[model samples]
Target: MTLVYFPSHFKRAPAIFFFAFFLFTLGVTHFFGGSVSLLQAGESKAGLPYIVKKGDSLGEIALRYNVSVTAIKKWNKLTGDKIFEGQRLRIEPFPLHSYTVKSGDTLSEIALASNIPVSRLRELNKITGDRIYTGQKLQLVNDRKRTEKPSVHVVEKGESLWDIAKQYDISIAAIKKRNHLKTEVITPGMTLSLKEVPEEKHAKEKTDEEDPELFEYKVRPGDNLSTIAERFDVAVSLLKQLNGLKENRIYPGQTLQLRPTSLDEAVHVVRSGETLSSIAFKYRMNVSDIKRINEIEGSKIVVGQELRLKGAKPNVYIVERGDALWEVAQAYGMRVEELKRLNGLTSDRIYPGQELQLGIAPARPFGTYTVKKGDYLGRIARLHQMSVADLKSMNNMKTALIYPGDQLKVTPFLQQGSEWLKISEINWDDLMGSSGGLKKITLGNGPYYGSRPMARRQNNRRYYESARLSLWNTYKRAQKLQAALDRKIAKMGRLSDCLNGWHIVIDPGHGGLDPGAVVANLDGNGDKVYVVEDEYVYDVALRVYVMLRLHGADVTLTLLSPDHLIRHSDPPVQTFVNEKNEVYNSRAFNRGNSRSHWPKGGRNGNLSRRVAIAENAFKNVPRNRRMLLSFHADIDHSSPNVPLVLYYRNRRTGRPDRASKQFAKAIQPFLGAGTVIRGQNVFVLRNSPADISVMLELRNLAYTDHAWALRFEELRQRDAEKVVRGVVEYVKGKG
Candidate 1:
């Protein structure tokens, strides 16, 4: 609190001295490997060590180096919330929510340490395959706490945890953890622990940081800036900046980007000569990365298509024929003249051979900055080496319009701690393994719908009342994960060459804990006959796994043996139970002795038991390059229920495509020998994620008729083969 007033007579002298001292200090800083401010606004230097690229999203950039999009935007004083290729983004010296794969650390272990979901970890790091190798950089996406924190303010009269969390740029979880509170309630004068964090908590905290919640998105054929931005809660301007839009456009064969907090999600891009393997290699990523990014249950990438590349750097746009210079400049936030100058041109005329810079153009101003999660304008300036006014001027921002994916210009500086460190090389095979989004499109007229026919439910005549509730519950869970899966798959799908590479985890239901049906003693001996559900499912799953492997698919099985899976309270089951009783309608409970028989554990040898086991197994299988198949033996004693199959469908809305039902169709024919009924009321068959899931009921395995049992193995093997065939076909079409 010391204030000295300037003397009137010496005012000019003091001003001159101050100016000289400032200049001298600035010179010394630069001479000593420090940065000098070349910008009139924004921070004085870039902190993180990476550069934003074309097809890059704010979330991807943040996850790459374990920072927050908000922090990055704040540091850069970014307006319009955009990023560009070649635009330098600040990185902390050591990342908080990231790890360099150690020799023994599995993906699951890494995810656990970072307090992030395994699926999120896979998507954040663009892992296309299973396994993590030594020296691989894996991102844990739960580190938003580093960038976003609760603020500490004296509680006034009436305040809630939600209100407090909102007040301070932090989440309710953070506040609860900081204050050691049991619930989100607060009391006056309690001195609640607020997350009054610094500008870039993600960068500031270097160790033991949890991963932030992250989402994945698949690139679609007609995806563009506006559509993706709208879906993910991101600004269109920000998307353009992160992706380095040489032209504000996107194609079908590319991936998308996303974050936990961003409304508009993240995305990726497609490149020439890029296969799943190549894409994985270039990004030090995996084929699974491509699959996850593109949301291709089967590997498929159309020409000029856009997939999802969540964690990898945004893609670069190659100069193409019939392009305009102005369009390019506007897309990348550069002057038309700058484009001309960068390409050594005097006029606007351009050529394909010129290879105009597609991503962020070169020549960035310097500065030091920290990124914040969910950061907006007005807050970034306070934490960095720039003033708010300066930031506006430097970034050419008229208002406080900013988003998470912006890079700011700043003065240069010497080496200091950063959230990101430079990595010179990336090994693709070690990171992504062989899995991606390259599949063939069935343009020909032979069985245009592939193996399984659309479920009988599509006809809308035989919708089961109780079954609809059961299916809707399961479908809701899948839908909840759909957005995230889409983001991951889109990234993997862009590599057409990588289409042949696919890591597929297939789950066949009714193993271990689930015995679906029970039979009574006809002789009156009071002895009960238990039919084993696991036996059939185990056989089917194994065959499918083998067939898929033989067909060049990298396949993993949820239960290779009866004992491989146990009845567990996780995943689809958990999701179903969590729903309101009204939504969790189940016919099994209404069946005689169903509730008592279908408890949590023990091999009951019933169809319901088998279904539960399969469902539980799916819960255990991580959401990376995966699909779930609940195999059942149908039993409809009366004609009312008949013997038809069903596939789940999402309520009609903006999202189109039979993602759920198609999977059922893919495997239906193999099970048709028992009883062929087509329908769409099954919950397991709804519009779920790219971990394509469906329920296949072998027509009459439960019937006493020997014909049903005779066809059991045939149906099992065929179903397995079909699953494999479908995956292979998908890969071929995409590749």
Candidate 2:
């Protein structure tokens, strides 16, 4: 009497027809959209074997639990809504279909709904830790008879033992133990004994390949198999097969067995054709040491196994009773500010026994100076190597207030990117060249800015060139910043001819239920305020759209503002928007898509719908003429020094598109010199129709200083302008 749920698209129409008829007979009718309406009721309660009290009816119970009356009736096989006291009913679902993990899904949540213990769930699935991928599959029931079903996998043409074991997410040692094979030799038509397979997929006559049907899962991180499958429009069950994951449980290696490893630094993931000796050779460590470190009994290793290399130590330190951040950082040859930043500490406070991550940052980028009596911002700026602005920006200072014992950061070597841009973005070299032709009597003694164009026009081009020499002498060493100031000579076309009618889609990552990287901060009034990912990201994206539109490019924003244009300030007015007001609107961006096409949902549904919007906007448009820039503020993983940028990973070869790579490089210099360009198989980039697409994590919001900047319009505008400027440079470079 267990009910089968079908996904949206009206799957199994005949079953749904009978279900509709059954509901009609019960004097209730229901409608469904986007596949299974039962999923809307959410996962079933783990509660089962219900002891029905007096006056309890199936309809009332269903209403209370937000489940369908039809589901309740079918689950109990009740002929009617009638019930009696002491009637033990099976309330939870019987395990049948495998559950695919999605973004933001937790194992405890899944286990509770499935009415199973967390420990038993781990044993049944064979996965350690809560790290499950989207599209991962999970087996819910504990039926030993399911494993007794001769779950043999027939060797395919040119298949290896490793391949078969990995395909089934079983251990090769377990296979060898089960089959009693000493050697790794096998032939076509030979069958391998697999440790696990679902009971429904086992067939005596079918000694063919792996089962066609499988279940994947959603995970907390959202970067799991289910999300991967959802992004690529492929079956997650198949990806599990590819990864040698059965029931969404990943063995240490796809085919080989591995001993448990500690959460320490210097772990190596075993690849195909690698053994202990090969891994030892790669890391230049002894094989005996490798075995001892990982606690392996033999030299045998498995593919995808995480082996701790020898002599590797844990990258964490336990705070002692007398240890302060300054003392600890100085002891480790690191800066105090960096230590605080790494641990996300807003104030310089420490407690004993608290663990801190020893980040891979090389000796801190900036030096710190302790404040003395009668010290002020101007005196400190001159005394230290950095500017007053740099000092204020780095410490998130609202005013020039400094205490006697305050440890202020001095970033002379350009740790703060925005302050450096303010000084270096001027055309210093061009000014040096023009200064040679200036008449001696034409210039004044004061510093000159070319802001007044009318005066220059009236003076017959003789104005301010003398002051250029004054400017030149002050900034003669500007060429040292050539790494960041690349493409200084390139023309950015005209403001009105941005790629001659290019179509751009600016997607602000995370919305609604996915608040993304939330941080509690304070506003200018010294009142508590919240900084959220969706709010600031939308403002940045909105700025990019406006800047691109001014350059005569067609721009589309995947999200709309409920507060309209009030969200984006021109002269940097609004500081922090705690509201999550950006809603999905396909028709709002491009006219081709309809308003009703997007459904109101949360979690990963928001991501998929953005990709759909990009695909629609670029339909029939030339691939080169379209680009997608997904702006997401990173927390925890981003580097303190530079922002993170990534392009799409090709599904087959695992390489980024040539055009996308070019686009990524063009914008990277503007973000910072050390900004890393990596490849992420993110759903939006992997699935977008546009060929040139990139996701930019503009800043590390994990640091309070960085998160504090997002609250103000000035910082957001700075981020947006740099991004738009980089795009223009990319277009110019292509030309």
Q: What would the per-residue lDDT of candidate 1 be over residues 465-577, giving only the tens digit for each residue?
A: 12122233333332332223223333431212222344554545443234333211011111212223433454455455444443345544433220111111111001001
Predicted structure with the largest lDDT when compared to the true one: 2
Candidate 2: segments with Cα more than 4 A from true spot: 1-386, 389-496, 522-528, 566-577, 588-604, 638-641, 650-653
Q: Could you tell me how far off, in angstroms, the CA of residue 274 lies in candidate 2 after the best superposition?
A: 48
User: Model 2, range 592-666, lDDT digits (tens) per residue?
Assistant: 222232222344254777888787887867767898999988663213223567788776786666678767756
Against the true structure, candidate 2 reaches a TM-score of 0.35
Q: 599 in model 2: Cα distance from truth in Å?
A: 7.3
Error of 2 at 1 (Å): 69
Structural similarity to truth (TM-score) of each candidate: 0.23, 0.35
* Poorest lDDT segment (10 consecutive residues) of candidate 1: 571-580
Lowest lDDT sum, 10 consecutive residues, model 2, at: 26-35
Give the whole-model CA lDDT for all candidates, comma-separated.
0.37, 0.49
